[model samples]
Target chain A: MNDVIKLLTSHRSVRKFEARELPEGLLETLIKAGQAAATSSHIQAYSVIRVKNPSSLEKLVELTGGQPYVASCSEFLVFCADMKRPLEAAARTGEDVVSGMTEQLLVATVDVSLMAQNVVIAAESEGLGICYIGGIRNNPQAVSELLELPKHVYPVFGMCIGYPAHEPDIKPRLPVDAVLKVDSYRDDETQVAAFDSTMHAYYQSRKGGNKDANWSQNLTPLFNQKLRPHMRDFLIEKGFTMK
Target chain B: MNDVIKLLTSHRSVRKFEARELPEGLLETLIKAGQAAATSSHIQAYSVIRVKNPSSLEKLVELTGGQPYVASCSEFLVFCADMKRPLEAAARTGEDVVSGMTEQLLVATVDVSLMAQNVVIAAESEGLGICYIGGIRNNPQAVSELLELPKHVYPVFGMCIGYPAHEPDIKPRLPVDAVLKVDSYRDDETQVAAFDSTMHAYYQSRKGGNKDANWSQNLTPLFNQKLRPHMRDFLIEKGFTMK
Candidate 1:
């Protein structure tokens, strides 16, 4: 396989990073790449906090569901879905700033995700390995407090990036036919059940796989019970209206 | 600047691509990288369609707000926020699929965005240039018919990727101070205005020192009135109950 193809096909999350500091302008360059991503309406409703302070990193690591990866990485960043700057822009220019709604929240959230991926890509190209800490959402209040995040700007996720100390095996994915459709959407139970077996095998190959190999079983708890339960309310409290 | 950093920082939308075919396994690698992105509830609620047929490309270009760029690139993909898979999964197994609503739509949309960004990054790392075609949303219904997309699966955007034929300057972004904040989200008018000026200068420079320069003037119409006016309706039509 081509080198780039190999890199993409076999990407693994890096949990350990070298303690060495990153080279200069790396953060700026990453942010630039992120900002270059396509935004809905060019709103660019996102921001990144470059957390280089070790004490702050410690606090963040704790807040991020006690994930040690947050502290171990040389560079940590929190991507924020920000609407405050645009609101401020409208305020100064005496323009209407009415998008404090749920729709706006969704747009900003999507926008931040797009930008954050760009950051990940840029970091990877620089020979850096990064892991996303979705655990950051486990305690959103604390994250907001630590980051001094104001209303209409919420932490979407945390990313830890640095030179890799250890390389993990590439995680397997559902087959192309399982996810890719030519025209319209189609679903076959047999295909999913078959894919479930494949996923189970993938898990068995790893020392620590999901508790249950069944994709549905693993997914039930995530959506049926937890995840984004109060995100809308949280956004509302933070200054977004779900209108 | 490092080669990787240069790639990240200097990325520009390349509407024109070399007719050269992608290397073997590259497409699969790109799709895998996309799948590895974080999915809400691990539902992986998205699908990608790789268009190789010229007639299909022409049809898409016509449907995508008549953007010639969509037809010009070597690889064209329409990213879909797909809920049909899990919905069907539940139906086949007689499980309740209760959450395929507005919130679910948000999850799928964000999920697809992150995945698409991963593909972009992966492609760029392999010396590919990409342009996101948001105009696909302009006439979602027509595009849907052309692509034979089904209910509950809507195309979020179209992406064209391949080798570049032009080297455009990196677009400027709002200042970090204006966008980034600590701990609570803060809105600062003066900072935003200054950044807007920076944007104006960047645009002016791009326009070869043209007279008009304010960023707001260039963007306000799109967000305030056009492009997004009926997107909510489009979502509803896709069988997403935005409750």
Candidate 2:
């Protein structure tokens, strides 16, 4: 495989980071790389909030479910799905802009995710570690207030980027056959079962066998509980009326 | 910039493609690279349907609003936001799975987009050209039926990958300052105005000055028109209630 593909496959989320800071202007460079990602219809409907204030970072650490890396990382950015700029720009053209459509939400969300993934890749290429903090969603309104996010702009997720202090084992993924279908959707029960065994072994052998749960069991908490049930009303309140 | 950063920043959507097939096993390698992207809580809530049949490709061309490249590209893939596998697996573990949370939708959509971006980067690194077909969302239900996608699975977007027949100029993006804020959100009207001028020059000079619209004017149709208003109901019908 090529170096790019090799780098892509070798990814693992890093939680522990070195105390050192990023080189000058590297964060901006990475964000510029992120802006290079394709946006739907050229509507660059996303924003990144870089938190450098130690107090704000500490506040974000609490807001993001106590993830210490939120404060510890050399750079913490909250990627926001923003329709405000585009809608305002279009409204300036006297085109009665539609503000809160479901497609608009989807487009902005996809745009930000694509952009953030590019930033992650660029950071990894620079030998920096990065982790996406979905925990930011646990308290979206608080995080929004902390960032002063305006209407039509919601934080999709936060990211922590810094030099790596620990190299975690890469988690195994589902078999390619399970996720990749030919021409049509196909049931992947067999593949999932096989992957369960694989994950069982992975969890059993990794880092002195500290964990015993398989992939499915690990997902149990996510599905069994009403996880983040507030997201719908929260998004709607933020002007993403899914109607 | 490093080669990887250069590659990430040089991305442009390639529509017209050479009539050539990809090297054997390369598509899977690209997809494997895609799976390496970080998933929320390791849910891996996504799947890819590789559409190879000529008839199906032609149908997708019609479904995606006369995008002939859907049929012309060497490979077409429908990236789906999938919760079926995870929910089913979790249910098998004797948990009453709660599906259709808005957070689930966000997670799966983000997962697929991140995964697809990785595939795009990997493909580009191998000198292959690619385009993201967001038009697939234009007729999600029809496309889903065509691909036999079941409940708890929805097509988020499609992608076309092939050798490039023509090189398109990389579209300019919003100023990094416009999108990146420090510590808090900030107004970007000045930056947006500057970028509008930048885009005006870009449109006036690129490819023999074929286009005249600036970035703001370009987004008017997308914002003024009720673009893809049916997506909300369609996704709801597909069991993504976004509740």
Candidate 3:
């Protein structure tokens, strides 16, 4: 197997971090790797805010639904899907300001995500561990204020990076047939069933021997509880019409 | 510097591709790497469709606004922001279908992007080149039909992977300070101005010695012409309420 494949295949999320600072210059190098990732039309519509201050980290943890790992991690970065630069550039160049458009927000959001993934992979290759905090979006306005995010820029996600304190098990996925379509999609019930079985076994055996909730049972309430309800008004208030 | 850092830092979009077949098992390995990237709450709401059939590739090129690279590339994969799995899971468990709401869409979109970025990095590490194709989104309906994408799953982007026929120069980025915010968001106008100068030099020296357009000048029309128009209705039709 290729080394990259080996690293990627057995990948697992690590939330527990050792109490250590990063090696010399790793932060700068990782950010550079992030900046090097592709941006939409080279607009580079994103920013990485390094939270080095302890008080600021505590605020970030509070904004991110009190996730202690976010505050306690060795390195915490909040990736922003930033239109502030482009908005400022437009102001400088005397161009029009596009208020409340889904197009711009979508581009910026995806752009930051692209960069964030590179940062994670680069960190992984250096033997650093990573966990993403989607909870950053839980309270976008608070996060924006704490991070001093200007208008047209919003926190898309946060990443906790450090040496791992524990080796989390590799999470199983739906089989390729269920997810990877060849020329067309197959919304096959059997495929999902097979995948649910795989997921159940994974939860049962590897994930601290937890009871295996099949794919449907685990997913239905998730859609009801957290993600589906809160995110719409959040994006709207953050200047995206999502038209 | 590490070889991975070199790959990440030196990445350039390769428009021209050499006529070479990928080694066997390369695509599978790439998909595995993509699947391993973090998903929101482990929902893993995304999929990729490999477009190997020539007729399908040709059609996809047309749908992608005549980006001929779509047809010419040795391997083309479409990254999709999929909510279909959760919906089907909901049906099996007697949960609501409207549950795949805006937040769910956002999660899947971010998840798909993270995976795509990993695939790009892994592909480059293995001596291949890739260019992400946001144009695949130009005609979502046609793409859905051609790829047989299901409801609640939209095409987020396409990717072309192959050996490079041309070695392009590394594109310059905004200066470190321009994009990297500290504990708080701060914009230094002087830094932005200086970075624009650096970018002008990068473009001038690399591409035939012509005077390069400043960053603001380059982006003015991009935000005007093609990108700002399409997303709202497209996303709506693809089943996101954008609530």
Candidate 4:
């Protein structure tokens, strides 16, 4: 296999990082490479905020429920799905632009995601370790205020990039049959049951303290509890009114 | 630059493809690479449907408003944001899982986007061209019925993969400063104005037929008129109620 394929296949979300910053201009180069990702109709509805202030970083750490890596990483970026750019551009041309729609939100979210994944691949290629911080959504409104995000912009997720302080094992995934269907969607209960056991073994064997839970058991809280239910209202307030 | 960086930065969406099928096992390998992507809470909430039948392909082409490449590509797969697997797994364990929430929708959408982009990177490494057809959202319901997608599973987007018959120039993006901010959000009016001219030149001189529109002007239709406003109600009908 080629180097790119190997790098793509062997991705692990590194949570620990060495206290080393990237080389000069490396982050800029990475972002430019990220812009190379495919955008729907070239709308490119995404923006990334580099969190540099110590106070803001500390606040975010607490806000993300004490994820210390948010502050410890050499570089932390909050990726935001932004429709304001297009709205402003259209408005400048005297077009009465629609600011909020479900399709617009989906497009912006997909756009940010495609760009962030590209950034992750590029970072991994440079011997850098990276992790995606979805916890940013755990407190989206506060994050929006902290990052000074304007209307039509919402922080989708945060990313940590730095030198790896530890080499975490690549976590196993659902078997290929479970995810990649031939022509139609089929139930994969058998595969899911098998994967639960595989994940159980992985948790017990990994370097981190043994977690006595399988994949299904681990997902109980996320499914049982109302997970960040305020997201709909939050998105509406941020100008993704879904009109 | 390394090969990975070069491959990523040189990405161009190829809508024209040669009539050649991928080698057996390459698509599977690519999907495996995609599964390696980090998922939220180990919930790999996604499914991929490979459309091979000529009749289904023809229907998808018409549904996506005559994207001819959708039919001519060597392989076409629809990346689905799926919550059915997780909910079923939780249900089997006798947990009363929450059926629909805004957070679930975001997680599944982000999960599929991450996986599909990895598949794209893997395909590119193997010298295949890929295009993401967001136009599938234009007729999501019809596409879903054609693919036999059950509730809690919706096609997020369709992807076309094959060898490029003709190389297309890499599309230029907004200036990095416009998207990447330090510490906080910043207004990018000047950047947007400058990029409009850049895009104007690109459209007038590109390999495709000359178009008389700038980037802002091009976005007028999407913002001025409601583009695919039916998505919200449709998502609700498809079990992503976002309640």
Give the top-scoring candidate (DockQ): 2
Q: Name the better of 1 and 4 by TM-score.
A: 4
The sequence of per-residue lDDT tens digits that candidate 2 reaches over residues B35-154 is 999999998999999998899999999999999999999999999999999999999999899988999999999999999999999999999999999999999999999999999999
Candidate 2: deviation at residue A69, Å?
Answer: 0.9
Model 3 deviation from the true structure expressed as Cα RMSD, one decimal place: 1.9
lDDT, model 1, position B6: 59
Docking class of 4: high
lDDT, residue B132, model 1: 83
Give the TM-score comparing model 3 with the true structure, all chains together. Answer: 0.95
Clashing pairs in 3: none
Which parts of model 3 have CA positions greater than 4 angstroms off?
A: A225-228, B207-211, B225-228
Instruction: Output the number of the lDDT-best candidate.
Output: 2
What DockQ does each listed candidate score? 0.36, 0.91, 0.64, 0.85
In candidate 3, how many Å is residue B202 off?
1.3
Ranked by DockQ, the better of candidates 1 and 2 is: 2
Error of 2 at A28 (Å): 0.9
| CAPRI-style docking class of model 2 based on DockQ | high
Q: If both were scored by TM-score, which would come out higher, candidate 2 or candidate 3?
A: 2
Rank order by TM-score, top first?
2, 4, 3, 1
Q: Is candidate 1 or candidate 3 better by DockQ?
A: 3
What is the C-alpha lDDT profile of model 4 across A2-105, one tens digit per residue?
77788988899998999999999999989988899999889999999999999999999988889999999999999999999998898889978787889998
